[model samples]
Target: MKSQGGHFNKIIINRILATFLLMFVAIGIAMFLGIPNPETLLLIVLVMITSIFGMESGIVSIVMLVLYVMYFYSAEHSFLLYNRGTELAKVIVTALCSLICLLFCSLVIHKRLSKR
Candidate 1:
């Protein structure tokens, strides 16, 4: 039989995987549509989806999304984008927006969950 801790860990893992997958799909869609500012809205959506499972998952999803966006920008620009101040600022803004959305959504989720 599985211990309670093991089951909890499994849920956490599953949350991470699900968040990652959803973010991947969102990113892909944005890219396919040539949306340069997709994160502005996509981050909110991603956080909302992850927060359904738990606050931690919502936080993790935003963190992972930020990292992925950073890497993706570097890759798409052949690493030259990092040398531009405006581009770097855009990345920072994106990360901040994502974090802010995650915090707001997670708090709402926490409050809802606690009421049960």
Candidate 2:
């Protein structure tokens, strides 16, 4: 599906790398503004994974979500929540972060294609 008009692998690789870079930038911004939570780290990683590869990208997104939840549940006193990661608030926050990552990559691809 990626070869009809242009090279897909390069686009994907570029997007993935750019996505990670954006995450670090986003995280750095959040940190500078005082997010004060480990969830920020998980969020940056999760968002990067979800965005870099689409929905069917792989099992990575699911696995990471589970782990984040697990850690949230076991810890009970994280800066983001109090008792594991099952809280609705935390899930929503994480999802929003992922969406941002998705948007960033989407824009990059869009710009590249548009330039052609």
lDDT per model vs. reference: 0.72, 0.54
Clash counts for all predictions? 0, 5
User: Mind giving the per-residue lDDT tens digits that candidate 2 earns over 1-116?
Assistant: 55644786776666556555654565456457765454656555655565556533313443444345434444463535455344656666665655565566667756776999
Q: Each model's TM-score?
A: 0.78, 0.39
Q: After superposition, how far is residue 116 of candidate 2 from its true place, in Å?
A: 3.5
For model 1, what is the alpha-carbon lDDT of residue 110?
74
Q: How does model 2 fare in lDDT?
A: 0.54
Instruction: Provide the RMSD of all predictions against the true structure, rounded to 1 decimal.
Output: 2.5, 7.6
Show pairs that collide, candidate 1.
none
Global fold similarity of model 2 (TM-score)? 0.39
| Model 2, C-alpha of 110: deviation from truth (Å) | 2.8
